[model samples]
Target: MKNKFVQILVTGILVASLPACKQRPDNDAARAKGTGAPTIASTLHFADEHTTATYETAINKFFKNGLFRSGFNGSYLVAKEGKIIAEGYNGFLDPVTKTDSIGEHDAFHLASVSKTFTGMAVLKLWEEGKIGLDDDLSKYFDKFPYPGTTVKMLLSHRSGLPNYTNYLEHYNWDKKKLVTNLDVLTSLYTMHPPLQFPTGKRFSYCNTNYALLALLIEKVSGKAYHVYLEETFFKPLGMTDTYVFSLDKAETAMPSFEWNNRRYGLEFMDLVYGDKNIYSTVRDMLKWDEGLRNGNLFRQSTLDSAFQGYSYEKAGARNYGLGWRLTEVENGKKIVYHNGWWHGNNTVFIRLLEEKATIIVLGNKYNRGIYRSKQLCDIFGDYRQSNKTFQELENESSNGLAAGGSQ
Candidate 1:
C-alpha cells in the first residue's frame, strides 16, 4: 500500500524574528478585535535544516518499519515548532483493489477524536457567557434523568451517565431506526437507565456525556450542533476538509473497512454526531492544533481548563481532561492526546504540549498499529525513559491492555 510518499521539509535557515505561536498567551480581546473569527497561523517557525532532516528521516523510518508494514491505509502528518516536517498518504480509497490513491485532501472518520471538537465548542459557549460549566443538565433538558450532572462533569467524563451505545444495544433499540443526538437524549429520559456511578464520584468515559452536550449546544445556541461547528470553527480555521458527518453527506465521505478488507455497513447507531462522526484530513487537523495554540478559538484560561485533569480517584499516568487524554510522563511533561475507534476507522490525534509537536494518524481500515503511533513521541522529546519500552507499550495497547479508558 506504500505506493506514494510525500515528504516536505521547510528549506530555510532559522528566522529569528518569527514569533513562536506556542509561547503566546491566549488573548480573547485580541481575537475579538478582528472579525471575531479564528485565523489559521500564517507564519510558522521552521526548524533548522538539520533538525528538519533528522525528524523527516526518523518519521519515514517509523512509518516504513511500523505503520505501513502493518497495512496502514490512511494519512499521517508530523509537525515540529509549527512547521510540517513530514507527512504522507498511502493505500487506496477502495481497500480491496489498489485503484485511486489516497491524497492529502481525503477525510477519514475521526471517531472518538470528535469529542475534542464537541468539548471545545461547549467551552467556547461557556467563554461567551452563553452557558455555565457548572450548570446542571436539568437546567437545559427538563427531563434529564441525572439531576446534578453539570457541563463540567460531562466534559471531564465524570457525568456517571451510562454509555448510550451499551444501553441502546442491550435494551433492544430498533435496529432499523437510525439514532440521532435527540434520540439518545430521549432514551435517557424515557428509559431512565441507572447512572454508572454517582455524579462526579469517579471518571467514566461515556459517549452519552458528549451526546447530551450536543443537545445543550443546540438549545443554547439555537443552532444544530453540526451547523454551529461548521460556522464557528471549521470555516474560521480554514479547515475546509473537516466537518461533522451526516447521512446526507454519506456518499462523499470516505468509507471504512474491516481489517480483512470487508466494508462496514451503516447500522442503527451510525447517525450520531457528538460522540463520533467527525470527518477530517491530517492537514485540517493540524490547522485545528494551530488554531487552539494561537488563541484564536479559545482563551488560554479555557484551554487550561480543558487540559486540566479532573478525576484523581485512581493513581496512574492516565487522566481525562475536559475533552483530551493526558499522560503526565517523566520530567513533568504532559502529552495531550485522543485516540478513536469506530467501526473500522482507527485514528490518533496527539499533541506534545510543551514540545510544540503534533502527531496525527487517520486510517479507515482497522489497524491496531495506529495506536502505537504514540511511541513516535520519543523522536521529539524525552518520553522513552519510562519502565516500559515503546515496543512493550505498543504491545500492551494493541492487545487491549490500554483499551479500558480509550475511546
Candidate 2:
C-alpha cells in the first residue's frame, strides 16, 4: 500500500513540476481596468473532473503510507464549486500532550505562507482608502533606503528590496535577543544596499517586501500587524483560529514530530514562523481555503486583482501576485497556490481554478507535503467530484499485501 502511494506521489510530482504556468498582471492599477489579469476559475467545469475516485485512490494511498511523519500530521479538505466534498485529518498534535491533530479542524502555523494573510491585510487597507497601491513605501519607513517604493511594487515583489541582513548574514542571531519589528527595519537599512532591481523593473521573491509591508500595515492603519489581520480579515470572515503571531517566548504553538526518517515538527516550524511564535490549526486553514475560494473575504472584482500574477518580462515563467501564486497546470488548467513552512511544519494550498477545486496538504518535513499534494493532484488530475470509501481503500490494502512506509 505504501509503495503504491509513494509511486503515485513521486510520479505526480514529476508530472506537475514539468510545466510552468504563464501569468500576466495589469501593471497600471490606476487605470479603470484595475490590474487586468486572467480569470482564476474556468467558465465551465465538471465537478468530477476536479476530483474523483481515482484521485481518492491516490489520496488514500498517500494517507495509508504514513504520509506525514514525526507525527508531522495533516488536515485535508477538498471542495468542488464552493461545496464541501471531503475533509480529513491525521497525525499527532502534541507529543507531550498526545492530542489528536486532525485535518480541516485543527490549526497549524502558516509560516511565510502567512504572507497570504498579510497580503490580504494590506489589500483590505487599500480598499478602505487607507493606503494606495503605488504609495512611496519609504515615506513612512522609520529609516528607509529607497524613498520611492510603492505598495503595489512591494505586493508583486517588484520593489527590489533586500529581505533580511541581520538574520540571513548574521548567522548566529541570539535567540535570546528580542528582534522587534523596528529591529528588522534597521537591519535591512544598514546591511542591504539599494534595491536589487529598480522598482517595477523585475521579479524576485523577497521577504523584506512583506516584512516592510507589515510595517505599512501598522503605520497607515494605526494597528499592529496581528491586530489588523484579526479585525479586517480574520474576525470579519470568522477565522477564529488564524492570527498574525509574534512569538515573545517559547510557547506551545506548533506541534512537532518525527517521521519517514526525519524530524519534521519543530525545525519545520522555525522556517515558517521565523523566531517569532505564530500558529493555526488545520481546521482554521480549511476555513481560510474555503473563504478564499468562495470570495467570502473580498469582492470578486477585488480578489481578481489580488490573486492575479505579475511578471516583469513579457514572456517567461509566471510571476507572483499580491498574496497568491498564479499558474497554469496540465492541459491548460489554471492553478493558484501558496505554501507555508515553519519550525519543521509545512503546508501546501493547491487550488485548481479550472476545476474550482482546492487541495491542502500540511506535513512536518520539507518535501513530504509538496510531494503528496502533486500526487494527489495527479490522481485527481482533472477529476471534478470524488466518491470513494475508506473500506475500498482497506480492501485495496488487503488484496495488495502492502503496508506503506519506507523500509
Candidate 3:
C-alpha cells in the first residue's frame, strides 16, 4: 500500500508539472505582442530551453525520491530565469473534510517568509523618504519600550529586542480575542520584559522586530498593514493570490495541519503581522522574487543593502539581512533565502542570484522534507558540486531546518 501511494504521488506531481493541454488567450496575446516575455503564468526566463528541460527532469526526480517517497504534502515550484521549469502541488487542504485537495492556485500561510514583504515595505518607505532606517522606534511609537532600536535594526534582526511571542506565551492574555500589534507593543511597555541583549549587540532573530515594523508601516503609511502591502506590493506586482491574513477570515482561508492530520489551531498571536500571517501561492511568490532580482520594486542600492550581511561578528557563513537570510557560499555568491514554520506550515524559499534560480516549497501538513527543497539548488549551478560547498550548505541547512515555528 505504501509503495502504491508513492507511485500515485509521483504520477500526480509529473502531471502537475506538465504543460496545460490548451494554451490560454493571454498566452496567445503575449506571444503576439512579440516582446518574447512569457505570460505571468508561463514566465520562463531561462537562457536555453533544452537546459531548462534537463534541469526540470532532475528536479522532478529529486522530488519523486525525496518528497514523494517520504509522504511530503504541499506545493513545490522550481523556476529558472523567468520561466518555471517544474512545479506541482500535493495533499489535502483540509484533512478532516478531505474534500478539497491542494491545487496550483491554493495559498499557504507563508509563516516567517512574510518577513520578506515586510522588510521590502520598510525599504520602499525608506526609499520614498517617508521614513529613515536609522530613525528610532520612538519616532513612530511614542511608548516603544526600547529607545535605541531603529528600523534598520528591526529589518536586519540586530535590535536585540525580545520576541513578543515568547512574552505572550507566559502572559495571561485572553486567547479568545485576537491580539493586535498594538497589544504587543503595549505588553512590552506594561510588562517591561528585559531585552535579550542591548541594541546593536549582535544578530538575534526576534519576531518582535517585525511586529514593530508592521506598526511602523501603519504609522508611516497611514494605512492598515494589509492594505498597504496590497496597494504597494501585491496589486502592483500582479500577486493576486497573496494577502496578509486576518482572524475574521480564518474560516475562509486555507487551513494548516500537523503530521497526524490534526488541524493547527489559531491563538491570540495570529493577529500580529510582519513576523508572519501572509498567505500566498507559489506563482505570486515568484513574481516577488523576480521583482526583487530585476530592480522593479526598489533601487539597485536598496537591494544591495538588503542582501549584504549586517553582522560580521557572527562566526558562521550565515547572516541575517533586511528580510532575507544571507548564506555566503563559495566564490562570494550569496544565497538569499528564508524558511518559515508557523502552525503546521513549513516553507523554504531560496533565491540563487547568480544562477537566477528559485526554489520554493510550502507544506501545510508538517513535513520536514520541505526544507530539502534547498538541495534543488545543487542542480542549478556548480555551487553544490564541491565537498566543501556541500558541507557548508549542509551545516546551514541544519540550523534552518531546526528553527522553530515562530521563526
Candidate 4:
C-alpha cells in the first residue's frame, strides 16, 4: 500500500544503490510499523521502448512493490549464455567498510533448499549401489518404522509423511535433538497419526520426508550427511564453499543484503545469513544448473524416471520428480523447479528446458512466497532486452574482505 508519488526517487540509479541513500520518503506511519527493522530500496523498471527486458515488466513491478522490503539478507545472479547478466546484494551491508564490504559473504541457512544438495547426494549414492529408489524405508532405519514407504515415495514426497518434526518445535528439545533428520522422524509417533492420505496417494511438501531420507542416506552410504555432501557434491562440483550447516564457517560470513522500499520505508530481506548454514555463491549454483544439463549424474533412462512423475494423481498429488518438481506443457515450455523454505529463508531453483536457462534466488528473509515467485518466473520466461532507460545497480562496497571469494 505505498503511494506512487514520491517513490520516483528510486528511479535513475542502480537498483542496488538504494540502501546507501536510505531516507524514509516522508512517510510517518509506515516507518513506525517497521521501525528499527532493516530496509532495502529496489525497483526494476523496464522501458516501453525496448523488448528484450520488456518481458520483465511483471518482475519489474514486483521489485517496485517492496518485495525487496522483507528479507534477512539476499543475493541474486541472473545468467545467460554463460555470463552473469544481473547480480545484486541488499541489506545488512557495512555502510562505511571496504569497497567490498561485509555484505559480500553473509552465509544463510539453506533450510529445505538443503534438500537439493541432499537429493543430489542421494542420487550419487544410488550410483554407487548404496540405495535404490524403490527400496522401502523400513529397511534402512529401525527406530521408527513405516513398512510401506519406499525411497522413491520419500523423494517424490509421496511417502504420506506429514512433516512431524514441526510438532517438536512446539516442545523444548535440547539442541542435541532438534531439527535433525532423526529427531524429526522420532517425533512422527507423537504427531497426531500416520499420513493424512495413503502412500503414493498425494503430494504435499513434507519436510519429514527429507529428514528421513537423510537418515536413509547415512544408513546406506555409511557416511554422515554433511561429510558426504562435502565429498561428493561440494568437492567434485567445485562448489567447495557450500555446506549443510557449518558453524565455524559462519564467522566469516558475507554481510547480509536487503532492499529499501524507498517511498514506504519498507525493508525487504532477500538472503539468509547465519553462523551454522548452507554456504554458496552464484558461480557455484551456475555450475549446478549447467551440470544438470550436460552431465550424466543419473543415467539417461534414469534421468527421465527421476524427473518424471512416478504416478498420476490429482489434488495434492501434483507434478513432481525423484528429487525435483516437474511440469509438462501442452504447447509451452515444461519446467522443473522446487523451492526451499525454512524459518525466514527462501530459495527458488528453476530450470526451463525450452529457454535453456535457470533462475535461482536465495534470500534470508521470508513471506514473499507465491506472488514474488510467480513474478520471477515471468521475468525468466518472458524478459525482453531493454537498455534504453534501464539502469543497472552497482555495488558501492569496495572494502569487502572477500569481494571476489569464490563460494
Q: The CA-based lDDT of model 3 is what?
A: 0.75
Global local distance difference test of model 1: 0.78
Candidate 1 lDDT by residue in tens digits, 1-407? 33332222233332222221111113343323322111122234455665564554455556756776788888787887677765556666677765555666678999999999999999999999999999988889885788899999999999899998899988889999999998999998788889999988999899998888888989999999989999989999999989888898878888899999998888899998888999999889999999989878898999999997898899888899999998887477788999999999999999998888999999999999999888778767667633445455444434542111222
Q: What is the Å distance of residue 358 in model 3 from its true position?
A: 0.7
Measured with C-alpha atoms, the lDDT of residue 74 in candidate 3 is: 74
How well does each candidate superpose onto the true structure, as a TM-score? 0.84, 0.70, 0.84, 0.67
Per-model RMSD to reference? 10.6, 13.3, 8.6, 11.0
Clash numbers, per candidate: 0, 48, 6, 51
Question: In candidate 4, what are the lDDT values of residues 254-325, reduced to their tens digit?
Answer: 333223321111111112111123556545676676666675455666556666776566733237787777
Residue-pair clash count for candidate 3: 6
lDDT of all predictions, in order shown? 0.78, 0.55, 0.75, 0.51
**Candidate 1 TM-score, true structure as reference:** 0.84
Winner on TM-score between 2 and 4 is: 2
Candidate 4: residue 35 lDDT (0-100): 33
